[model samples]
Target: MNIAIVASILTVLVGLFYKGHKNWLMTWLQNFCGSLFVFSGWVKAVDPLGTAYKMEQYFAEFESTFSETWMSFVAPMFPWLSEHAILFSVFMIVFEIVLGLMLLMGAKPKFTSWAFLLLVVFFTFLTGFTYLTGYVPEGVNFFEFGKWGPYVETNMKVTDCGCFGDFLKLKPKISFLKDVFLLFPALWFVFRHKDMHQLFSAGVRNLIVGLSIVGLTVYCMSNYLWDIPSNDFRPFKVGENIGIRKAIEATAASNVPVLAYELRNKETGHVVRVPYTQYLKEFQNYPKEEWDAEQIRGDQTITVVKDANGRASILKFYEEIPAEQLSDYLTSHFELTGDTTVIPIATTKISDFDITDMDGNEKTWEVLQTPNYSFMIVAYKLYFEEGQENRMVYDTTYTYDTIAIEGTDSVYVERKVADVQARQVSQSVYDFDDDYVARYTEVVNPVLEAAQKEGVEAFAITAYGDPAMIEDFRHETQSAYPFYLADDIMLKTIVRSNPGIVLLKNGEIIQKWPYKQLPSYEEIKANWMK
Candidate 1:
C-alpha cells in the first residue's frame, strides 16, 4: 500500500537523522503520523465540499440503519447532520490539519496525544463499518470476489468513505487495515505522552498552533464557502475527455466485479445460494447441480457468509449488467422471490455520470458530439434567493381568446394553444442577493447570448431542483440558454463552481471558470473558442 511505502521511507529518513537522539524511535513515529495526518487533512481541505457530500452520504446511510431498528430516536440527528454536512466538513478539516500540526511540533503532548487517539478511533470505526458492509448478505460486494462491490466504495467518494478525498481511493479493506496499523502508535502516544519532544519553546509553539488553526480554517473556507477549489483532481478536471470518461462504464475491465448471482425458485420456496463467478455458464447451473471450479469448496453454504439471520444469504447476479444481457437478471428478479441484490455495476468514478434534457431525452452523447465549441453552465441548484426573496412569476402559458369582430354575432371562435416563458422571480429588489442574481443575470446570461451569436451553443445543467423550479430560475434570471438535468453529485463533481462555466470541444474540457471568475465572451473566443 502507498501508506506503508510512505511509512517505511519516513522511518528510514527519520531514523537516520535522529539516531543521535536518545528517543529517536518516538520521534520517527511522531513525524510519520504527523506527516500522514497533515497530508490527509490537506487533501480533504482542497475541496471541502467533496468531503461534505461524502458525509451527507454516510449520514443518509446511517439514517437508514437507525430507522430500521426500534432505537429510532437518534435517526433524526443523521438528517440534521446531512443538512449541516458542509459545516461539519469545514470544522473537521480545520481540526485534522491543526491536530496534525500540533502533533508534529509537540505543541501539547497530553492534549495532542488524546486528540490523535480519539481521531484514530473515530476513523477506524468509519472505515471498519464500510469494510464490514461488504459482507452484508444484501451488499453487492458480499463475497463476490475478484472485484469490489458498489458498496466497496463509491467511485472513491460518493459511496466510499472518501478518506483521502479524490486524491486516492483505497479499497475498504485497505482503509480498515491502515487504521488498524495506526492504532498501535496512537496507543503509544497516549501512554507515553511525556516522551514526546517539543520542537520549540512554549510561546513559539503556541504561536504556531494559533497561526495554523487560523490559516487552515481560512484556506478551507476559501475553497468551498466562498469559491471553487483552486485544485481540480476529479476526472472532470480541465483537459479530460468526458465522452471517453463516461464510456469507461462499458469498457473498463479493471473495475469489473466478479459476476455475482442469487437465484431462487418462488414455486418451491427453495432458495439457492450460488458462489459468485464471472462465467455466465458457471453461474447459471450452480443451484441445480454442483458446478465445477477450483474456487468452490465443499458445501456451498459453508463457503458463503451467512446473512444476518444466519441463513446463508442468497446471491443475485450483480445487477446493472445492461438490459439485453440480463436474461438471468430478469429471470431471477421475476421467477424468484428473494431480495434482489442490487449491487451497482459500473459504478466506477466515471461510470455513474449522465445528463438528460428537460424533455427526458438522454442528451449525454449528443452533448459530447456537439460540434465546434460548446459551453456547459453547471448549476448544482438554481433559485433566486432564500426567505422572502423569491416569488412566483409564471410567465409563458396562455389560454386562447375568441371574439366576434362585427356587430352581427359570429358563433364560430378560433382556438389555439399558446406558449410563453413560464417563470417566477423576487417581487422586490430588496429580496435579491445581488451577488448571485448578478452572476446568473449579469454574467451568465450576457456571456451565453454572446457565445450563441458566435456559434458556440451553451446549455445549463442543474440538479437539486425540479423542472418547474428550474424554469422559474431561468426566466427570473433572464437566461438566454436552455437547461438540462443531471445528478446533483455529478454536477458538483463536474466543476466546483455552483454555477460554473466549462468550455468544451468534441467532449474535451478546454477550460473552466467559476461564477466569480467568468471570462468575457470576447476573451474566450479570442483565446480558444474561435
Candidate 2:
C-alpha cells in the first residue's frame, strides 16, 4: 500500500529534480507509471456498494443470452463469489499498491513492467469489448479510438465504468480515456529499464520506498479496518448527497421505513437504526434470550459511521457472530434430516433404452428402493459461468433449443436455461449446468455405479417458466421418489455435482454422494445402517 507513496515521491524527483535531458525521459516514464497507479487506484477504490450494484444490474440483462448449461453454472457460482467479494477487493488493493511501488522503486523492473503492460493490454481489450458487444451498456465508448470503424453505435448510456472498483467519482468517459492513456507508461516501464536494481539503491532509495510503503499501509488500514473511506470523497463529506442523520430521522418516523432498531447488547445502552425490512423475517419473532434484533442493518450502520468520519466503526460496538452461528441457526430451525454424520455413498442412473448405443432389444430400467439407502431426486438448472458468453451464444443449445428433453417440456426449460446463461460476468465459470449434467451422467454417476440397479427410480427436478416441466418431472419418474425442486444455490451447496444424490433411511439422509462418485447399494447400506 505504501508503494503508492514511494512511486509518488520517485515520480516527483524524476520529473523535477533529475539532471540533464534525462529529466525528459524520466518525466515521461514517471508520469506514465504514476498515471497507472493513480488511475487504477481510483478504479479499485470506487464505492463497493455502487460497484456491486452496477455489476448486478449488468447481470440482469446478461443472463438472458446463455445456454441452459451456462445458466445453471452462473446462478450458484455468482452468489458464492459475491459472498467473498471482499477477498477480491483486498487482492486488488494489494496488487495495485505493490505494482505501483515496484514501478517507483525500480525493483524487478522487467517483470513489473511486463506485468503492468499486460494489465494495460487486458484492460484495453475488455474496455473495447464492452463497447463493441454492448454487454456492459454502461461506460464510455472505447471503440471511438479506431478512426473509422463501426462507429455505427449500439445502445449505450452514461454510467460509471467501475475501472477502479467504483472507488472514485470520475465519469465513464474520463475513466475510459484515462485508462487508455496510461498504456503509454505501462509500455515504457516494460521497454526502457534494463537493470532493475538501478531503480533502487541500498540506502536513500530503500528509506524512501520503505517509508512510502509504510504510509500507504497505514492509510489503507485506517480506511478499511476502521471503515473510513477517503475524507475528501466520503458520503459524510460536506457536499455529499446522502445524509446519515436524515436517513435516521426518516427511519424513526415511519413504521415500514425499511429501517429497524436493535440494541448493541443487553448490557450496553446503545441503539442503532437500520433498514428494517432487510431483517424483518429473520428477527420478526426472534427469541431475544438466544439472540437479539437491531434496528439498523450491519452494513448500513458501518457505512453511516464511515460517513460521519468516525474513527472506529459501530461494527466494533456490536457483538459480531461468526458465520457458523447463522449456519447452526438454520440447521436447527430447519431440522435438516440430511446426514449429520459423514458417510460415503453414491447414486447411479442408466437409461434402459440405449438409443444412443442402438440396443434394439427391449431393456427394463430398474429402480431399487431400500430402507437403508438414501434417495435423492435431483433437479438441474443450467447456469453459465464467466469466460463462456460468446461460446455459449455460438453453442446454440443454451438459447435456441429445449434445455431439458422435448416439446411437451421444452418451451419453459429453454427460456429458463437461456436466462441463466445470459447472467454471467467475466472471470466466472460458464455453462456450469451442462458441464455438471454431462460429467455426472457420462462419467461420475455411471463409473461408480457400474452394477445395474434394480427397482430404484431416479428423476431430475428442475423448473422452466412453465409449471408443466415440473409436472413432467413428476410424470417421468412417476411414483418413484419425489423430485424435489430447490433454489439453485441450495442444490449446488447440497452437492458440488449436478443430479446430486442422497441416501435416505426413513426420509432422512444417511449418506451423500458428489457427482464424481456414486456408491453401490451395498456400499450405501453398509455406511447408513450403522
Candidate 3:
C-alpha cells in the first residue's frame, strides 16, 4: 500500500481513539516523537566530527551538482559552508536534543509545535530531493524527468543522508518514506499542540530544558574539541581484529558469480548465452570446430551486496577472463600478492587502513600483519589556520631623479627620491598548546624509550604535508620514534585527536587513548609490553 494511504488510515484510527482517550493518545504521540529526536541527536552528539564530515559530503555534492548552471550562483557558497560544517553540526544536534526535551516536558507547547513542524518540513524536502535525485543522472536537470532515462536506480551524489549519524544509515528511498510517515504525527501536533500536558511549572520546565541544552553542548564539545569520543563506533574500534575482517571479506569475494556467459560464433556470427555452470561443464568435451570458433561476448559478473542504507544492489562487472586461464589468473594475481582483492559480495570496513612513510613507501602490511605490539601516534594536521602568524614588512629605497622646472629651459636637478614599500607577510604557525605538548612529551617520551628497551616498535603517523613542519615538530619535541606519513582522513579515523595513541597487536586494535589520557611508562611496561 502507498505510505499516504497507510498514513491516512492510521490518522482516522488515531482520531477515533482520541475521541475516547484524547489525553493518553496525545501524551503517547509526544513521548514517541520526543524519544526519537533525543536518540537521533544523541548519536550525532557522540560523534560530532562524523556528522561534520557527512555535512561536508552533502555540501560537496551540492556544489558539484549545481556548479555549471543557473544554480551556479549558490555554488561558491558551498565551500564556505563545508568549512564551517562542524559549527552547523553542533548547532543542529543541540537544537534537536533541546527540542526533544521541550516536547517531552511540554514547555512552550505553541513554540515547540511550530518549531517541530518547520523542522519536519525541512527534513521532508531534504529527503525528498535525496530520493528523487536517484533517477536524475549527473549534469541533468533534476525536474526534467523526460531527460532522465528509465528509473533504474539512484544516481545520487551524496549517498548517506546522515540523519541518524553513524549509528543508523538509512537509504535515500527509505529515509524519504520515513519522513512521509512522520508527517502524520507532525500534522497531528500542529492541530493538537494545546493538548500537551506539562510535566512541571513554566520556570522549572524552562530551567530543565535549558540545563539539558547546556549539559549536552558541553559533552559534545568535550568529546570533539579535546579528546576522542568516549564511545568509538568505527570499524577500527578496540577489540576489532583486522585479520578476521580480512578473512570474512575474502570469503565473501570467493562466492560464485551470479551472471552467465555469452559466446559468439566466429563463422556464423551467432551468439548464445548459457549458464555459467553449464558452460564450465561442457568446456572439456566441446567440439573443437565450435569451441575454437567461439568468442566470449557480454561476459560479466553480477554480485549483490548491501549498501550503507541497507539496500541490496545488483553490482555488475564487465571485466572478462578466459575460463581456461581463470584458475591460473587467480593464483598469479591474488594468491601470492598481499593486496586484498575487493569483490562485490561484501564491503570491507578496514580496506583503506593503510600506512606509508614520507618517501611514499607502503608499510601497512608490515606494521599491521606482524605479530607484535606497536604504538601508533596519530596527528592529522600539524598546524591550524587560527594559529597562523601575520606580519607587515616595509622596504625603503632611494632614487636620484632629474627634472626641469617650468620656467627654466632644460634645467635638470639631481634629487634623492625615497620610496616606502609595504608588503604583507604570513607564515604558518603551530600554536598547539605549548603546555599540552610539554605534558604529552613528558608522558610519551618515556613510554617510547621504554618500548625501545623492551623491543616494541613505536612511531608517529601524520598527513602528507610540509616536511619542514614535521621536522620542526620532531626537533622541538625531541621525539625518538620515527615519523611516517598517512592521509589526514585516515589519521582522523584512527583517533579523534591532533595527537593520539593507538596500541595494535598483530593487526588487532588493543587500545586507543587521547593525548590527555596517555599512560605512563611504568603502566605501559606493566600492562602492554608483557
- The weakest ten consecutive residues by lDDT in model 2 span 348-357
lDDT of 2 at 434: 53
Give per-residue CA lDDT, model 3, range 1-530, as digits (tens).
34234334544554555443347667766766776788789988998988887778778877876776678899999999999998888888999989888876778888998888888887787787777777786668775668774332447766657788767778788988877887887888889988875675789998898898899889888878877787777767887666544444444554444456555554665667767778778765445566432333332223334445433332332223232233332343232222333333334346556677767788876777667888888887665333567899998888777788888688676756488899989877664557656744786777778777878888888888776677767877888888888776667777777678888877777888877778876786677766
Backbone atom clashes (below 3 Å) for every candidate: 12, 60, 1
Give the local distance difference test score of model 3.
0.70
Models 1 onward score TM values of 0.71, 0.34, 0.65
C-alpha RMSD values across all candidates = 12.8, 22.0, 14.4
Q: Write the per-residue lDDT of candidate 1 for residues 174-281, one digit (tens) a residue.
A: 888999988999999999888776676799999998898899889998987677787887878876666654543343333344434545453454554555644365
Minimum summed lDDT over a 10-residue window in model 1 is located at 296-305
Q: Quick one: RMSD of model 3? A: 14.4
lDDT of each: 0.71, 0.43, 0.70
Instruction: Quote model 2's TM-score.
Output: 0.34
lDDT of 2 by residue, 4-101 (tens): 45555665666565432244454446544755575566444433333333444344333432223335556455554555554555555555666666
Q: lDDT rank, highest first?
A: 1, 3, 2
Off by over 4 Å in 3: 1-25, 125-133, 136-155, 254-348, 384-446, 464-488
How many steric clashes does model 3 contain? 1
